[model samples]
Target chain A: MAAEVEVVKNKQVLLKDYVTGFPKESDVIISTENTISLKVPENSSGVLVKNLYLSCDPFMRGLMRKPAPNSRTPLPAYKPASPIYGFVVAKVVDSSHPKFKKDDLVWGLAGWEEYSLITETDLLFKIEHTDVPLSYYTGILGLAGITAYGGFYEVCNPKKGEKVFVSAASGAVGQLVGQFAKLTGCYVVGSAGSKEKVDLLKNKFGFDGAFNYKEEHDLDAALKRHFPQGIDIYFENVGGKMLDAVLLNMNMFGRIAVCGMISQYNLDEPEGVKNLMWLIHKRINMRGYSAAEYYPHYTKFLDLVLPHIREKKITYVEDIAEGLESVPAALAGLFSGRNVGKQVIVVARE
Target chain B: MAAEVEVVKNKQVLLKDYVTGFPKESDVIISTENTISLKVPENSSGVLVKNLYLSCDPFMRGLMRKPAPNSRTPLPAYKPASPIYGFVVAKVVDSSHPKFKKDDLVWGLAGWEEYSLITETDLLFKIEHTDVPLSYYTGILGLAGITAYGGFYEVCNPKKGEKVFVSAASGAVGQLVGQFAKLTGCYVVGSAGSKEKVDLLKNKFGFDGAFNYKEEHDLDAALKRHFPQGIDIYFENVGGKMLDAVLLNMNMFGRIAVCGMISQYNLDEPEGVKNLMWLIHKRINMRGYSAAEYYPHYTKFLDLVLPHIREKKITYVEDIAEGLESVPAALAGLFSGRNVGKQVIVVARE
Candidate 1:
């Protein structure tokens, strides 16, 4: 009865089973009954982290299902009795790894539980800038930030004064891409699921123009009307019909940087693209990219982006959900366009 | 006694009307009535040429039809009552231009006639190295050759030890791309419509592997069988089903150079690609290019390829039709894959 108080317990959300169709909140259950020793064992290269914030992304929905047998992605099924892991910002309670230390802040792959023990030290990044919101490490200052940067600059190779179009422009990555394009002297336009998101892209993220894709009956015609000169660069976040429409309105030598295809992920089979033949006529360049492959440029990107954040030259918004129990609703919110900006789950206070 | 004259009249194949469906020999009528007095008017910027050879490419079929009102390409129906113009190897009978003179052999846009009066002098290239066959100028040493070189080297950006797949592998452009990939140390494989072309690619063109696409029931499986590592570069010539399959088998960071879509040109509506979603998953880069766009590099390309031709280091094959009257059948041969190598008509004796 050392303190005569409640033991600090870890809580997590577990997948009850593989999901089909739209995921329901009951597909996952929040449980709190675990504890990790706040000490690193001798000769062990492990770091015990108390997670502070977590990211909720659309791709997480893909991981809810048992991966197809011959799939190339490392999205294995979440064991029924275990916690799910994703990008998280945490405080290292104890560590034996030389690169990290006790009481240091870090961000990497962490479990939904309050505490996670990381064995592989290579994946973790020590947080250097504390002036910005720590929760940002889960979204804008983390994987999503680097993804929007690398996919737009390295993959799309955007030229100044070019016309840029982004799908899912109000989402985490899309919002950043639209802002980046605007900063780069491009005429940036975006498409969102609803009128509210469209307004956010224009007024909040400062996109040059925006449209509600749902209201447009003919996507190709809408694109033609908006981008009369044709799009020079397309940051593809939502695929399917949007991609098909983009193909029809691409200018000669246009570049498409494919980051994600959230629209087609839940479908039983992906939709067919009808305007692919336009690829030949317009002489477009479409390239896909993953952020994990571009980690070498992380420091360079941080140097470039962090100063902008401090100067208030770059602005970010977040939809924060409190407690680990709120993770289910936060994740489900991504598909319905409920998140206003970067979606995050705050687990605990500093 | 009258001069021993052969009547030396210009013979032309005039388009009777804009064609529909499959073109026939009756669509074009060969007549020997037109002659320009075999003279270049004083101060006129024209080169009177004795056409030696004419190229028959699938693009010519498009010229046979009326272009849609809003088409980006200027390709339109051949002037209703005029002779068709295309790539040709010709001897200048007379020239008002400074760079060319009588007896100067040149290759460029010329009428599908025994003799043509070319007004655009800048489009013509004076034959410098004719050590190889003259017909090679119409295929390997001409626009087709430049298309293969620029599209693969500039667009695809080949890396050594990369896996490269080319479609229509035994055609004028495909054979050269395979050879170029081989020279760059890429593991090159190609697909052809027939077994004979497959053998030609492996035995004659030094491709790493070859296959007849027409015989493969499952193109995705075929790609996996040949390229277990997946294709790093795809030189897309045929479109439709092959594109859908290749999308599934492209590696992360793969590049696709869309030079032509021979398969879809004759169709009333272009075939839809079903697996385009794979473009985002693998981070593939697909681009289309035209040889016309590489005009600035033509001199540099000629310097590189002409020497290869002179050394016999690069081999080119041509299927020759004996007269101007054979133009329509030769052009139609492109659609059915009936001609081996480049289908060319010998409009006049070289």
Candidate 2:
């Protein structure tokens, strides 16, 4: 006996076309014409999910562009008139896959629409710990969390008493990296775009020092002032002039873990970095990494960070936008620094 | 009774003043005004050596400049009116230091003069194997040898069948790095400034592909032509635009070991690198290192390379400058890409 299929309106934020420079709200369209089935089709290996949360990450800017020929970008590009997708927290409505089932809480690659039929279950993760806010699954407990773990703990390999500096502090991963550095017993300083964010970095993230980068005319002088003894580790989020300044103040054998270069993502021509020669003079090690590469460490990362979150040893801040329709403004706001901490959009509460 | 101290005329290449940019022969003065004895002074643990071979290395340009305030450059600056010094192959004439003795051959840091009283014998290494040409000590057995060994083997960590690229490919360290990549079972390409050096890279260094970077309008396109699969490892001897181009053509998880940035050394304001954002996309690991730091691996490096030299499996080219008088021109010529190979100034044959 066959059962009647349940269909519902699936509101989405669709990409109009590939972005050239800075993305705008006009680049995305709010569409409600699509209807999605709540059931996974018979004999099909797919999971039907109700999107609960969608992340507004800086890396999304890359996905909005048409990839160059022979480009090796690990993430897939968005297709025109299709719902843009990224790391998301969703509730499984139904599943034909063995790993996921109905009512299962999960977080991973999903669409920005109200409902998504995820075909690749490999990118999905079944959420285990739900005591702390489920909204965290969109950020600190998801890709952003493991990114800080891999880039800082694995790449930078910070040691106790080492001096650490983080640019774009108070943002999703930067905020986490600062907290991680503090937990590692390193003296850490962070630079943010706003005084309010700087305050959050020092007060909320427990950074040893914090500064508003917008007020400083000389980035190099700013770094020198905060890092008088020279920085031993740099968690690079913003690139360009800030990266150049950090290079000048880097200690010998210092490490720079480049998780993102948000500053150059929108430029027609990315800004040139002038101080890379210092890498040789100071024997610095600088590496770039994506958090998805560290998914294998999710369980281990959870074991370490979950307890810290509960014990108040570490904390996370998120700026959430209500409803799926808000994604156009929310995603565009990321480049303009309109949101604080992790920028996330809510499609549903549960 | 003290033994007779036989004083002799000591010719030196002295720095007239700290250079501002693009060193000219006039910046360095040839002076024969000094005289030195063949014996170490009383109560001093110094070693006196008659310079046989003086290495004309690119790093010397950094020392010729007045170092920036609070700069973390590991190399010391050359004082005005003082004889500049660098790695040299010499015969120990006399020594009060326990490690060195009269007539024993050595290679290490020494003055750019006929005879030098070297107080820092710690930097010196006794010449153990004399079967190879003594001139080889100025290059293949000295800092240039280890610079290539460390930057390629220790830093780049090349895997078999990987693609490798060397910038400034016909220079001292770059020549060796290309050969080392070939020895490691890697496909190697080299970029030089002139057609003659490009021929040397292919014919002498056994590079799979050689291109005159000066002839290429777009370095990125040139790299793409040579490295269709993209570069897995880069031995970065020349920074600036070369580094930027290499970044564009790097494969995922590529490693770049920057031993020197010869192109940027003489610039008042070093050229800006525009493609650093690719570092993030490609997940590249770029590190800088000085061969001196890898002195501990000198013996292991020798054991591996000596046999290759003996079996003619590897070869070295030397651009021999005839006398101390030729140094002013030789040192300045390095900036203008005048030297075809490892430049060595011969003060004495034996």
Number of the top candidate by DockQ?
2
TM-score of candidate 1 versus the correct structure, residues matched by position: 0.92
Predicted candidate 2 versus true structure: per-residue lDDT over B1-350, tens digit per residue = 86777999999989999998899999999998999888888888889999999999888898998877866566689999999999899998988988888999999999899999999877899999998989888888888899899889999888999999999989888888999999889999999999999999998889999999889999999999999889899999889888888998899999999888888888888888989888888899999888878899888989988999999998999999999999989999989999999999999987
DockQ of each: 0.58, 0.82
| Chain A superposition TM-score per model | 0.95, 0.98
lDDT score for residue A99 of model 1: 87
Against the true structure, candidate 2 reaches a TM-score of 0.98
Best by TM-score, which number? Answer: 2
All models, RMSD in angstroms: 3.3, 1.3
Cα error, residue B327 of model 1, in Å, equals 2.0
Clash pairs for candidate 1:
A288-B283
- The CA lDDT at B214 in model 1 is 87
Retained true contacts (fraction), each candidate: 0.71, 0.80
Taking the tens digit of each residue's C-alpha lDDT, what string does model 2 give over A1-350?
Answer: 78889999888889999998889989999998999888988778899999899988998999999888867678789999998889899999999888999999999998888999999888899999999999999889988899999999999999999999998888889999999998999999999889889889878889999988889999888888888899999999999999999998999899999999999999988888888878887899999988877999999999999999999888899999998778889888899888899998888898
